[model samples]
Target chain A: MKSQDQVLLSVRNLVKNFELRANSGLRKTKRIVQAVSDVSFDVHVGQTLGLVGESGSGKTTVGRSVLQLIQPTSGEVIFEGQDLTKMSFEQLREVRRQMQIVFQDPFASLDPKMTVGSSIAEPLVVQGVQGNHHDKVAELLDLVGLASDHAKRFPHEFSGGQRQRVGIARALALDPKLIVLDEPVSALDVSIQAGVVNLFSDLQKRLGMSYIFIAHDLSVVRHIADQVAVMYLGKIVEIGDKDAVYRRPSHPYTKALLSAVPLPDPKVERSRSRIMLEGDVPSPVNPPTGCRFRTRCWKATDLCAAEEPQLEIRSSGQQSACHHPE
Target chain B: MSESVLQIRDLRVTFNTQLGELRAVRGVDVDVAPGEILGVVGESGSGKSVSFLAAMGLLPKSATISGSVKLDGVELIGASRKAVRSVRGKSLAMVFQDPLSALNPVHRVGDQIVEMIQSHQDMNTHDAEKKAVELLEIVGIPQPDERARQYPHEFSGGMRQRVVIAMAIANNPKVLIADEPTTALDVTVQAQILEVIQRIQQTFGTAVVLITHDLGVIARVADSVNVMYAGRNVESGSVQSIFDHPSHPYTRGLLSSLPHEGIERLQPIAGFPPNMLAPPPGCGFAPRCQLAIEACSAELPSLVPFGDLLSSCIRADDLRSGIRS
Candidate 1:
């Protein structure tokens, strides 16, 4: 368990809303899409907090808002004892050096024309780092399990996994205290995914850095995350340690999602009683007033439709946001 | 085994590209019996999708396919376009991963199914439209009649896939090829889609050729499974036999590499998949295979009998037992 004193990042009541215009019979109308709503969690130093959900569940939005890549509608992001939400642009630039990000697609993140070494060194140059940038680039490449000679090559010259290593190397160039990895391995093949995941673990150990790992794959999240948060339509449906959540998920949505994941073990896969939820996720523009997941939940009742539930610790020892939890 | 609704033998597909000939499929063989699900699983460029696409005559003109694809003794490899078209809708159908691409955005969902019906057999527009609504209802789509009038963009991903399934089973095809049908949907929605597929298989007694990279999907539905590696069928057996006793080293490596809740650290296959343009003369998986011996790279191993399964590895016999190198 992590000590309470070393809280690296604390996100409180984070909300993100996107406004869009719609054309209805030649009349234009503006609509509000609530991507994330009132989300809160804490990340301990030298640890990982995994945020997992399917597409449109706003897991990526939460990650982006925490990094202030996009301004949140209302929230408090307390990183390293400083409120990032309240910081001005001038103050934020100084704090940005310690907070970095690694994207899922390596091809799009890196510039095609620039050499991999320059891509990693650009951050150091922007921060006005004094030491030799080339040496730092080589050191970073080696740290990410890439050869030092790979610095001269372009992003296109490297494979998907190698390019992701370069992305990780770039994120670590400023000696960041925390890095937000958004679906870093979801785009990778199963064989290559493990190597990148192992490199992430190795880098964390060597640097003693905190990570906010965002991904849709629960199995991959289970491997790296010490604490896990399950998001559904911008809210944390469940939050607990890896063992408690994965072993005994209380909410219907969590149980359904976990059961839906097919285990490679044929014996277990064949015998398991799968929870087949009906219909697709509702539109975020006009989300269900109460529980966002209640539309498809089998345990839906009037209370679920009338009153929203709070994410509280239940008898199962995990915080699940559902009134009728199993 | 029951009568095989579809059979493939010595299936090889090659594409002439700027980078020379890329052998997409290398001597693949598959058999799908009536009312049975055969899951073909592999990573990207493993030839799982290309083999089935070639069988369906969906490949481009530049690609050359030399294989024996028989649907109830009807040869499809050398068949003319007219001949293949006749059998495609009535007896052979396919469901793709992204229904958004497969479905025509301009046409209503019901009209598309009606078009399929009118093209295949003699049916008026009214009767065809009614049958289309029935098909939608069968796939578990809510408000079948109302939904059929909407375009592809109106439906959610899971619903669009159901519409695709509806279009596939419109004429009760004998063999349904689903290539990653549930990959684009959510996990909970994927379970629903899988259930719909199973129900269709049982009700119509149609053979299903399910191709995907996820082993979990295969384990849930496939009665028989084929493990492909570097454009070849590395292992083939019943799902039970393959899961309980995987003989091929490649199969073992893939299973071990898969992330499971109980696993602590994943055992990643060291090397990448072999390049199809200039594949190794011997076993393609030998470079990444952990149990590979000296003889493995000397000559390409054939699919030989190994216990109840067939594995293309020289050490298949040794691996079938409790032995480990």
Candidate 2:
């Protein structure tokens, strides 16, 4: 069991809603997407917590909300005994030094006009780290497996994997305690993805930092995550230790997701029975009545639509939000 | 094996750019039988895309092509522009990576599909529109008639892909080339698209050449697999043989790098892919291969058969004998 002191960050009842104009008319009605809904989790120091879900599942919103990149509608994000939601704008800027985010698309995230070296050094300059920035830039480039001379090149010169390495080096420039890696390897090829995932694992071991690794690929997450959280329609349906969550998934959504991952072995793939969901995911704006997965869930019943199931501890530390958990 | 539907022999393609003459594809050979699903698996810049682009006669004038590409006994290489266009939309069709970009945003999806049908067959507008709705229904699009009127942006990524599949199969092409069809989609949605493509192939009895970097996807759908590296086919075999016993070092490394179901840790490949413009003197993968020998750097290995599998490696015999040295 991990000690409470080991917890580097804790989130409670986090909620974020975006208001948009319903239609183009004199009466501009407001509509909320409810991107995140009552999400809570903890990240222990030097450990990785993987938040996984499909598009519009609010995984990215939760990551941004934790860093206060965007304002949360409600709930507390306690980082080292400080509630980030309560902090002022100036105070939040100070807190931002300890938390950083590596975006999904390195090409879009990195400034095209700027050199790769300057991009990495920008974080150091912002944090007022007293040092020869050039030397520090070279050191960081070397850290992420890029040649020191690569610092002179632009983002376009590097391949997808190299650009992502540059992005990682920039995220590490501030020496943040927690880094939210949002689909860091999803854009890269399979061979390149393995390289990036290894680099992330190696960085965590060396820097003793925590990561909220957000990705849709469960196999990649299993390689690095200490705990895994499965999100569906803005809610975490299941979360537990990586082994427990993967070996014995309680929620039907989790089971469906696991079964959908095609094995590399042809024999195994042919032998496995795929749990093919019947319908498409419902619109997030107006989700299902109760369980969001009930629309396509094979095990769903009348009770599943009557009331939403809250995430509750099923065992010692494992949690699942399901009416009929396997 | 009776008569290959699409046969490519020693196909080479080079693009004249400001930098230099970039040889995108080099001496690549591929064959697809009727009703076969041939999987072309490779990393980015491995020429998997370029090879098919050349076969389809879709490359621009800037690209210089060589060798032979025959589709159903008709030569695609050195064919006149009109000759290539004659066989393109009707006899062969390609499903590109991004359905949104491939589709015209200004027109409704149903209209675009109807245009394809009318261009290929002698059908009136009314009959074409009805056929378009039926094609959407065949692809499992919910509320096909309603979706037919919607524009490309109105449909979800998965639904847009379904529309793309519908367009590819509208003319009932003999061969369909899907280039990374599921790269932009989520896994579940990707599975749905794959199922739709498989259904279309089954219903139409068309051969499929699926190009993707994801080995898992290839394993799920491919009857035969061809592993490409640095613009060359390094390994080719039945799906079961490639997965169970990969003779080529690059193929083995790729399989090991993938995070499997029960494996606790993933073993990533060490180095990046070689530059295509200035490929290595010998095996393109020699620098990163763990089993590379001095001979591997002296000359390029030829693709040779190894117990029902073909691998381009000097040490295929040693690999079969479980000998590294």
Candidate 3:
């Protein structure tokens, strides 16, 4: 692939299964939970692809599987012309230098005993980047809009927003090409969430880093994502450009997810008719026979229960897995 | 006009800390009519939570509260320990943000809720357990009988919050205070929780004080909105008035900065919230306000009535004239 046209990371037919124990004490009756089944997507250079789903929809599992943090049962993760799944431990460790992850909880992710500066410089030390780590630490802090003086402070001393900045600085320490932000700002206050999000956008612009931003909030995804993927029970129900997917959602699950987001304006919230999906999300271990969302989908039919629909492009690069597409 | 179910006047709450006395709430005035959901919107340390904690007499011994908190014309603030305890769960109850931490880990969910009802009212254990199941059903928890027997860890995050709500409303308090109730749940589940709260508020006709940082959650449940900053009320009005024509610069900035549905890009407000320990001398939001002036730094502004709204900014007159920069 040409340099500009090269796909930074491509996942094909990724399948991740967990051997969860059944309710009974029978070890013979082992059950498997298909956390991610046949999920495929590509992350281009300097682009962001958002993975959105409600709780228990396996969005986080997909993100972790891409990083090879969890070994996938079957699939290919082609990153920079190498299949990460087929790589050995040492090869995967080398690949990890080019990819980093910013976890959801800033407090939990950072070591409580370490200072913020030491935490950010830890990756450089591990990679044996020979230099004055203090200078690089200050530079990383400045990049994420933190003061140089904040280097000495521990994570507990800083506010929630500042700690997230520290997390971002740590993510950038390795000079990675791709950063998987798994709900980076979900644990923050709204005002603080905006600051961190803006910092992410600016850093992406400055460093040209690709991001796989995973979040359940559609509004936050809209501001950051170039491409959007809606997942339902370990499957990509819809994937398209930000505007096309949000403005004209093809799948019923995508539409319901969009309609469920509450608008800031009271008048608009009162006037808008919401597609409130009834019933809870089914278990992933034994999901519906065909379409996972067919149980609660309004447009589901007998055909939906019998035949699994493949994700296909309908118009203008927008793909959706639905028997009845809007 | 309907009688106010709860009236709070000049509420001042301060916590005695090692550093000094930290004034968390300063001269807050709030009133809630029957069946109205009053939203208190602000970032952390804005005194939105502290104000209600003082009203409910839920603060610790270190907290020094001076103000009148009246629920159904009965004073709560500065009441004796026994008197406050007597009215706490019966007349006014609060549901905290994290239900997992709020509920007892060792006790069954039903027992904890039953304890809440029995402590305030003269009910037997059997009757209280019956009432607890009724509350679980009221909050829309399926299989209430079986779910009630489970521990806090057995239920999901959303279900745990429902159990917390069940405990709060077990005594049928006249006023309910939900402090960031849906902050811990997912968006879809947050909507469901908010809808359940709204439905319960309507059914019980309880005055609710919904405290949260999310403007979207506020919009869905609030009949009135209060914009707080640095331990002070910057703006207060009917929800429609606040959304349509916000008189304060801080309120306008907050409303505009929110990422609404169908909007692609968000306009983030510059600067951070003022430090409550050492807030600015005059208007708390002057440092972040785009339309701030030298006069705004000279004297603190009091709540003044605008067109169908109340704002503390001196430039409220100019706010509607489109002079905000």
Q: Pick by lDDT: which candidate is best?
A: 1
Expressed as tens digits, the lDDT of each residue in A1-326 for candidate 3 is: 75435589999999999997666664557889999999999998988999999888788998899899999999999999999999999998888999999999988999989999999999998888898999999999999999999999889888777888899999999899999999998887676687788888899889998999999888889888989999999999999898899988889988888888888889888889888776567788789988889998889999999999999897757999999888
Which prediction has the highest TM-score against the true structure?
1
Q: State how far residue B81 of model 1 sits from its true place (Å).
A: 0.9
Model with the higher lDDT, candidate 1 or 2: 1
- Once model 3 is optimally superposed onto the true structure by TM-score, how far is the C-alpha of residue B27 displaced, in angstroms? 1.9
**lDDT tens readout by residue for model 1, A182-211:** 999978888889888988888888899999
The two-chain DockQ for each candidate, comma-separated, is 0.75, 0.62, 0.48
On a 0 to 1 DockQ scale, where is model 1?
0.75
Query: By DockQ, is 1 or 3 better?
Result: 1
Clashing pairs in 1: none
Runs in model 1 lying further than 4 Å from the true structure:
A1-5, B321-325
Candidate order, TM-score descending:
1, 2, 3
User: Can you rank all candidates by DockQ, best first?
Assistant: 1, 2, 3
Off by over 4 Å in 3: A1-5, A21-31, A111-115, A131-135, A149-157, B105-115, B121-133, B143-154, B260-265, B323-325
The TM-scores, chain A only, for the candidates as listed are 0.97, 0.96, 0.97
Tell me the deviation in Å of residue B105 in model 2. Answer: 2.5
